[model samples]
Target: MRPDPHVDTVDHPHADDLHGDDPHGDDPRTGSAGHVRVDTAALGRVAAAVTAAAVQAGDAASAVPGLIPPPRWASAYSAERAAEAAGHRMRELSADLSGTSASISTTVLEYEDADARTSTRFRAAR
Candidate 1:
């Protein structure tokens, strides 16, 4: 029989493994239902895009200010410097967020790949 694409083919929990709290105990792979749900691979792709945009925006924010015409007043220049400092801080924050999102995306994709491989092996064994 051809495998159903919607079904998660991981090893199902045996009757002995079922507990009162675990209602979908028959399918351990799904942890809820027999179906494969929650597309984390798509989420990872979105996260990657967000990370890239954030980093790019941060870089632009850091660089674009230098091109701004300086204020004629000395006091205004100090304010501009302060604003520039804030921009630097924002760049750092964006970089951190990018790193975190990239890490999350990588982890999610890796998990999905591993889960698919394990499920495939389990089905083959059965």
Candidate 2:
């Protein structure tokens, strides 16, 4: 049978690319990297929402231009920069969704699901 495309049957995507201690996923190397990447998709939606509210609240939409998708990077940059102060914020959104690996793992039903361990206290009471 043909294998699933999303399966971890092939080379890891971000293994070589990711550095030490990545909190979002397992660290390929020995050391742990605490660099947890926030869900950009979530961030984008929230940012767009707040921007929309600003436009509705007496803020000129034309003066701001696009609402849902700001056609330009500069406009989004200023807001993103403000949101993520001190850190270098990139305007481009990450396509990788959260819990993808977990989803893939769960889909593989071949995993053992024998049964939960019987509590000794309950067994003794019987």
Candidate 3:
């Protein structure tokens, strides 16, 4: 039988504590069994990049309609409609990107606030 790759076999310090096997029935690092760590700096950078892409998408949306020339024949009407639809889709994408950027920013702010509150509590306890 192949050894389970997902399971760690090597013994290490605090391994049992991390796995919720502590004798005291609580994690030593925190009061909980699991922990979450977020890199706000990286999230901020990603939010900035997303915001930039949204701006570019908005610019493209604005330019798309004009790039397609006026319909000169009956058959061209469908092409014009298609171009308009493409532009509309681009606008939707830009809106979605903007929303995503805002969400990321909000998440970073929430994480930072939680960290600050945790630090304050720890300091007060100390």
Candidate 4:
């Protein structure tokens, strides 16, 4: 399947740092010196695209059994098994995509919440 054009698949410049052992090195809550900006709108778009793809994959999986004819001979039994396996894999892919979409949406919400809390804290401090 073709990748969604709306999703930014490019790796971030600080991608490595994000997974580094220094948990507080870039954490905003720790008064870190670095900043990481999140584009929540873009993330929402990505989540939507992933959800659509998951639906398509689920539909394809449902149709796989009908598309593959029943084995008429012993030689075709292997082919039938393979088709069943493919269908199973497609179902798994659909589930994974749905999970990924949910995770992305959750990330967007977390970022927005963090921004709002930070803004409130700054206002209270002033």
Candidate 5:
């Protein structure tokens, strides 16, 4: 019956600190002097690596059924089918991860390009 940790509760202790306030000084929402830093190149590289690892893990999982022979006992008869299903699901998950990684990479590139353009425009104005 406990509240979900991910959902923000209305009665949170720091909820009042997010907006305009002079009680404790600075606003919690805005960064120092309205500046933020992002490193898209590093993010893209890490995502790419995660994609590769997912694919590799899927490939290894798919090969597991072939590596381990099923037992002759009656209890193990259902286990073979379960193993096959797991391998198939792993491959599907791997493909999904790869697509997500590609999407993130594209987003990172676009974000970096936009940042560069913005910086260039500001420099030109000066």
Candidate 6:
């Protein structure tokens, strides 16, 4: 069966320190440093774009005619999804990079490939 492009937003906890690190901590210009957790349930709206992108990527892979099957590099898909989640988190983060602009602390961006499996995590910096 073909994979579904529509990714379900699992019941993940809303976290400010998803990245477990903060960039704009104790900014004298920003007044104070803190974290803002979000309602994962509300993540539905934010997850839409990421889901679509994944579907597109998958479709693109299916179209490519290569010597071998397109690699099932699951991390690539997961990263795309997490990136979307990060975008959502960035918006919800309460930092004024500009008027109504959420300046989320840059989190740890890393990718690891495991034999037969792969994953990527985008932890939002505190």
TM-score against native, each model: 0.56, 0.22, 0.69, 0.70, 0.61, 0.23
Q: How high is the CA lDDT of each candidate model?
A: 0.66, 0.37, 0.73, 0.74, 0.64, 0.36
Candidate maximizing lDDT: 4
Q: Give a tens-digit lDDT track for model 3, residues 25-114.
A: 445463344343355777888999999999999999998636456558976888777888999999999999999999999988877776
Cα error, candidate 3, residue 17 (Å): 9.8
Clashes of each: 0, 5, 0, 0, 0, 5
Residue range 1-126, candidate 5, lDDT tens digits: 344565422221233454534465433453332223345656767788979878786787767746366568776778777877888888888888888888877877776676777778879999
The order by descending TM-score is 4, 3, 5, 1, 6, 2
Q: What is the per-residue lDDT of model 6 for residues 1-126, given as tens digits with 9 covering 90 to 100?
A: 222345421222223335545554532432335322223333434344444554555454455343333357987667666666655555433122222211111110110122112212443332
Best by TM-score: 4
Off by over 4 Å in 1: 1-20, 23-31, 34-36, 67-78
Cα-based lDDT at residue 69, candidate 3: 64
Pairs clashing in candidate 1? none
Over 8-94, each residue of candidate 1 has an lDDT whose tens digit, in order, gives 333333444454554644456555444444456566666878788777868776675453676699987887888887788778878
TM-score of candidate 4 on Cα atoms, chains taken together: 0.70
Better candidate number, 3 or 5, judged by lDDT:
3
Error of 5 at 39 (Å): 1.6
Worst 10 residues of 2 by lDDT: 88-97
RMSD of each: 5.9, 17.9, 9.4, 8.5, 10.9, 21.1
Rank ordering of all candidates by lDDT, starting from the highest: 4, 3, 1, 5, 2, 6
lDDT of 1 at 57: 65
Q: Is candidate 2 or candidate 4 better by TM-score?
A: 4
Better of 2 and 3 by TM-score: 3
